[model samples]
Target: MLRRLLVSLVVFLVVGAIGSYGLMRNALATPICYFDSVDEVSVIGQTGHIHIGTLDNVNAWVGTYLIDLDFETAYDVYDGRYEGYCIEDIYSPDNEGGYALYDAEGSSANYEAAAYLFNQYASSVSSNAERAGLQLAIWEAVFDYGSYNLTQGNGNFYVYNGYLSSAITYANTYLNSLNLFNPDTFNASGYGLVSDDNPLSLDPQCYQDYIIANPIPEPSTMILLSSLAIGLFGVFGIRKRLLRG
Candidate 1:
């Protein structure tokens, strides 16, 4: 009876190990692909205000802003005023009755706020190259925020709002704590695209293309591997016991 039990245990463990290994192998072999050939120009030129369904949609809006505002002014305004507003305040259903950005009936307060800030600081920018660099940085930050929110949940306004608030707090604290905005200490490329041109034109689909190129590792791969290891260990231990018996 002892030998029979050991044999059965070993068989069960072997089967489980095989199953887990198969799953892991399958997961490893199949790579998930996202938007690869998305046209950057089309993405940037999109003027129709709509809900952000994907990173592409967000990119389209960003592209529009890039075209509309000078890079330096856009950067200063976004960096300064982004913290003052929340995604919830910008897109909340309550504001749908009034003026809103993406909603049907409301006015686009978010764009207006950014524009106001840009106009306020536009005169301060001296160099076109510097402005372009700053614009890229702002775009990258916005893209990062939009991408993160999308991952939390597709079209989840609450998640996006909370994330936006937290991101602003974190960025402001980090920038202020170190007083790191000086040109000598700052690395603008780390933030976004840098260019020598007066107005930087970004491919509308660049963000989505980037996402497709860099696929995050699936969490399930680790779980499957762990299960496989446990199963193999169990099988090995049971076989050893059987041999002793």
Candidate 2:
């Protein structure tokens, strides 16, 4: 009887450990950021900076390589701080930044600029598919840097790490979907100063968007279910052994 109890306990511990580990692994695989209402303003503000900065950086990187445009010129086009031909002027409100070029349209000037740049770069490449691929790669790098900066930067409160984590999660999903960063083929030579160490999965973003779109089992819930399963299996196994004996 003692031996049987020991066996059951051992089984329970082993099963619990396995279940906990599996839950942890799953949690790590699909990181979810949890936040309270207080974090909304900060998160939104930081995300905005990330978005604008990324656009400016991508324009700079691509324009420098393809058209030999200087960094200051590229910066002025996207950054609202400067006057004339600024993309922010078209999309955001007057109080938000620069003067509006036109009445608010379907797409913002930021996106318009991005599309224009993509087309310009695409025309330079001989292969249509390669051109699309290169554009995607540049976009991916831009977002990757944005997400990385948001998560790692000192913009948000350290206690509210979830805000940054959420940002990174969203960014990762968007960038990963593009499928442009294959280790074998992607060459970052002319793509500005994109760090080799910066990978997509590490950064997280868009938690609110992601959570609404994808509702997955919580880690606690998963562990609870796993424990219940282990208990049931142990009970059944013990009953079978008793019957056999």
lDDT of each: 0.28, 0.30
In order of appearance, the predictions have TM-scores of 0.20, 0.23
Model 2 per-residue lDDT tens digits across residues 1-245:
74677577667766776776555534322223211111111111122222332222121111112111111221122211211112211122112211112111112222222333332343444432333233333333433332322333432211123333433444344344433423333321111111111111213221111001112333445566666677668867977888898
Residue 9, model 1, lDDT: 60
Report the poorest 10 consecutive residues by lDDT, candidate 1.
98-107
Give the alpha carbon lDDT tens digit for every residue of 1-245 in model 1. Answer: 55676577667656766675456434422222211122222222112122232332232121112111111221122111111111121121121121101110011222222222233333343343323222222332233332222223333221233223333333333223222223332322111111111122122322221111011233334445566677668767877887898
Candidate 1 stretches greater than 4 Å from native: 1-202, 206-244
Q: Pick the candidate with the highest lDDT.
A: 2
Error of 1 at 175 (Å): 4.4
